[model samples]
Target: MTVHFHEASQSVTTADAAYAGLDERHAVQSGPGTFKVYRALGKRIFDIVCVLMALPAVLPVVLIMMILVATDGGNPFYSQMRVGRHGKSYRMWKLRSMVQDADAKLKDYLESNPEAKREWDHSQKLKRDPRITRVGRFLRKCSLDELPQLWNVLRGDMSLVGPRPMMIEQRDLYPGRDYYALRPGITGLWQVSSRNESSFADRARYDALYNRELSFFTDLRLIVATVGVVCRATGH
Candidate 1:
């Protein structure tokens, strides 16, 4: 799939109009024709098999991170409501990568920092976020914080490759229809590509492109690319 990168100034309305001609029915199905067995069944099977094989290596790291994160006297795991296929919501889990009162800190910090607030509004992330702890920074860089999402993949609330899960509150901010038609992914086009560099709105374009070009080989390629991203520690 050729992912188009738009200027960061692009508005939600503009992004939506860009894909206004996309067929919603076709977006839900993998590629063109009906009876695409992979989208219906094989994709889920792939998620399960990959997760099962990965758990052997992933579980130990998760366990270790849990203890390390909890050493600060807070819950080691964090979960938040995320929009899933068909606009359904589910609790997406992750290893805690922030302080116990991250929300409160963020609210107060943003109010005092106009520049930071602008960044958050545009990308929904903070490069120099004060909420991240010392160990948390390392985990975020290595992307170990996202390993817990392997459970979400097994639960069928997510895919190994698809659009990144949008926050429940971001439902209004998102302008593309493709994300609602498919399960969210732990790593996808945006995540493996622009990631932290792009505005949150750019996700719509990547999600739509991914859906329009959905295929077994596409998922496989994205999964392999994810491994390289993780090895390079490109997160955060």
Candidate 2:
């Protein structure tokens, strides 16, 4: 699972390489496997091409979802800061899939329901969340809530395939700064692999793995798998 880091400036010196390869006891904790330099340019090109190709279909759906979200008497779009590559922050966009004042509602609901509170504490999610509108819930089930991120992809704030961005509070959970090396994605290894069913720690591992194994074939496979996940309405 170890892919050596490339790039001359970030290169591993002989001494450091030896130290990293030493017995597990003496090994340096260098996050996950190294980044694949060769994939860098190709990945961006692929993201652009794919997003452009999907725009015709995606735009219409986004417009319809906007109307549906607005019918609930709230803003149809949501934007929140998410940690991006190199620990920089960016506004990640989404179609609103929750009621107005969702945070406040979540607080009130959690205070009243111990079971829901526990679920939130464990996974930061609730299988039956009370904050989501009916339309929002359906959008979320189909992962349509994330369609607005096509703009993020287009703007270079995200990739078509990479680790999903984490909240600022989840910063420490990263294996190291390695998670910050790649732009986050709307769908990724974690989403297609287990979605909310996997624990936070497991998701982190998957994120690291995806960062390591990125390539044309890898991205293609994940994208194809993501379609199946969406068609099955298994996303959240």
Candidate 3:
């Protein structure tokens, strides 16, 4: 479960080959590898069961966050198109963690700030983004902004553990096909690892690695790690 950062040239070729090899292995190991069953069926079932169990406690927090977010005078929940399994597009839900005009603000901010633009171009994230509201900052810090994605899990648009869903526009930026082979997740190897420290391009490599090591145990370990990340408030 180690995440290695290879040079861009090597990483892309490695990820592409890894995915091709993984598909062949899954086909051949279908019968002997119970993990195959977990990937195909058990994973979805596990997502549903885990979401069901978590909802009771999570709902109240979601409601509270919604009210707090709405105080800024806009929708509390935000949904954006994200690339999902098989290159399909789905609306990924999240509690709004930015101002109502976040996109517009981001565009202006990037255009005015050369350094910030470069950072955004590299990672598609801003460490000191001006678009985030106070409450939104806290929610994102605690990883609570993503709580609404449980519904996406129940709807089969996402899994409890898989690659972090990429924006539709980011499809070409992804270097491997592994992301399209499985559902996007609320949290995954990338999210549990040193995510903030990694470049956006590095995501495809992590996604490929996760696919290569896909198993019930791997998913379980990632889920547990996600809890630790939330507890540590490491999320941006």
Candidate 4:
């Protein structure tokens, strides 16, 4: 199966000679001559249903985490501008998992520690980041810090499964323009594939591949894999 993305239409065209036809509900219009079928519309419905189902369990956990994050004196929630589908911008939310002056501390720490600076420059992350609070460290280790993003999913700023959202400055790190066609997700192909263990280049590759082979089945598989990844305490 080969998948081609059309930038003009912002649609993905799956061209698989051996595969059977797609259901009408999932079909998206390609340009003039071609007909492309993918689950873009269906995916949105799935996201809404999944978010609604998860909210009952998720809300209480979010409330607890909010208070815990506020212990150090600051906003319990953090929001940053992130690039979404079609290069649009949205505020991506998270539980505050770092000190209030995290960015400033990062700059100072980078200046003092050459090894940490190298890691940050390469991966845009520091394994032993000094900006993380004690509570923040625990939140991050178990992936609880990301719970607030369920709101992002509820608000349609993100999907349940898709590409991980990127910071505006990190947009260029994505390998292709095709990536902009899909909305970023709270957890995605890269998250389950290797979590934080993968390199930047490897993450981009997974993102592209996910977009190319996107389908209802693929999304379902990724979602299931995500649960297992979380259970193993393997996420960053």
Candidate 5:
């Protein structure tokens, strides 16, 4: 399957020519193609417009997060590089939920506990991580930590819905080259469907499936389901 990265939206605007499909090394000429075109020219236009439309509702939440972080004595926004379509890297931004030196603490924790290192080998999260601050834990559980990602969507680095983007290290940890075909999304099938409970292999399967069948309606379904999951606090 050819993994394609799109402007994390419904816009046709581009810094690069719309990428044609992959080179022949990964071509599949004889199969019934199930992939729908969710990440496409017009889809991005939809995304940009959606973000603008949603700003009225989204602003209050963003302001709330900013207030908490600012009062809590930490940076309000966090940015990290993540792999996007075709393995290209982009800065994925989010609201900060950890202490300022969360990354440094992760390095220390990994070195101190062999068991944690074992989990980190395949899955990047610790089961009971100590680095997440109080507000961070609440934000993550409530899905509020991701509010800043809307800006990422507006910037075209990611989409509002699709496969979830992984940190740079996580991108390298994934096992397959074909997985890069889809752009990393803020909320995707894996996220609303299983999220924190899912294993790496399960996540890879869901993302691949979405890539094989990308479409506007399909994405809309995912987005609606994502809202349900978040509102119900059913998935992390």
Candidate 6:
């Protein structure tokens, strides 16, 4: 039984034979690929350092947004426990996108709004959620709502780039996927490459691909691309 995983990247075919495309499913399966040395440590160390350094820059944005949420809304920040490396669950922070009771209201909205339900069914996200605050709409469009996750990155809960961590419900939806094999990332391959339009299955494929093809330079490329992504307001 040969399972396969492929993702977007500068492909590094290794020297080992007999195990082409060896993935989370087959560690024993060897493949001829450039196994970048100390890639994980390098990636994590850089994540901590860069994110910590970025705190000062991010704080102002946080302060401004907190006021926006507080004056008109309530709670400037919200945290949801997302599944991380090896099935570890940790609180992933974000600037509040929807009303405080958004989670509780989700069920009712999903039942009533079939169009919203379809989008969520396909992408695990509601495209035009009415529950989202006015400030949140701009925040989502500008990708500003995610600025708070720098805290998560600093706290060692996430990476600047990696497989996008899934909410427990989202992870449960993809029960067949290997949730425990890799760490949850702040921005995954699917996010940088194509996020809003991509289907969940397609996103899953890219996630697996990124895991097999992970590297420092690749991560660097993702960081650079992220700026473009933000400027273009690519994330929904």
TM-score of each: 0.85, 0.81, 0.86, 0.81, 0.79, 0.80
Identify the leading candidate in terms of TM-score: 3
Off by over 4 Å in 3: 1-32
* lDDT agreement with native, every candidate: 0.78, 0.72, 0.79, 0.70, 0.67, 0.67
Q: For residues 1-236, write the lDDT of model 5, one tens digit per residue.
A: 01123324222221022223332312353222322233557568778898899999989998988888776786888889988878889998888888888889999998999898887775676767878777777787778888788888898888877677877777645765545876678777665444454556667766766675566655666677667656655323
Evaluated against the true structure, the overall lDDT of model 5 is 0.67
Off by over 4 Å in 2: 1-38
Candidate 6 residue pairs in clash (backbone atoms < 3 Å) = 7-209, 13-32, 13-33, 14-32, 14-33, 15-32, 15-33
- List ranges where model 1 is wrong by over 4 Å: 1-35
Give the alpha carbon lDDT tens digit for every residue of 39-133 in model 4.
54778888889888998998898899888888899999989999998999999988888899999988999999998887876767777778889
Give residue 106's error in model 5 in angstroms. Answer: 1.5
lDDT for model 2: 0.72
**112-216 per-residue lDDT for model 3 (tens digits):** 999999988887878899999999899988989999999999999999888878898887677888899999988776764555555666787778788877877
Error of 5 at 194 (Å): 2.4
Better of 1 and 3 by TM-score: 3
How much is 71 displaced in model 3, in angstroms? 1.3
Model 1 poorest ten-residue lDDT run: 1-10
Candidate 1 residue pairs in clash (backbone atoms < 3 Å): none
When 2 and 4 are scored with lDDT, the better candidate is 2
lDDT of 2 by residue, 1-236 (tens): 01112112222132133224233432242222222433657778888999999999999999999999999997899999999988889999999988889999999999999998888776677989888899998898788999899899999999987776788877765555556788988777666555554556666666666665565666766687678667777555
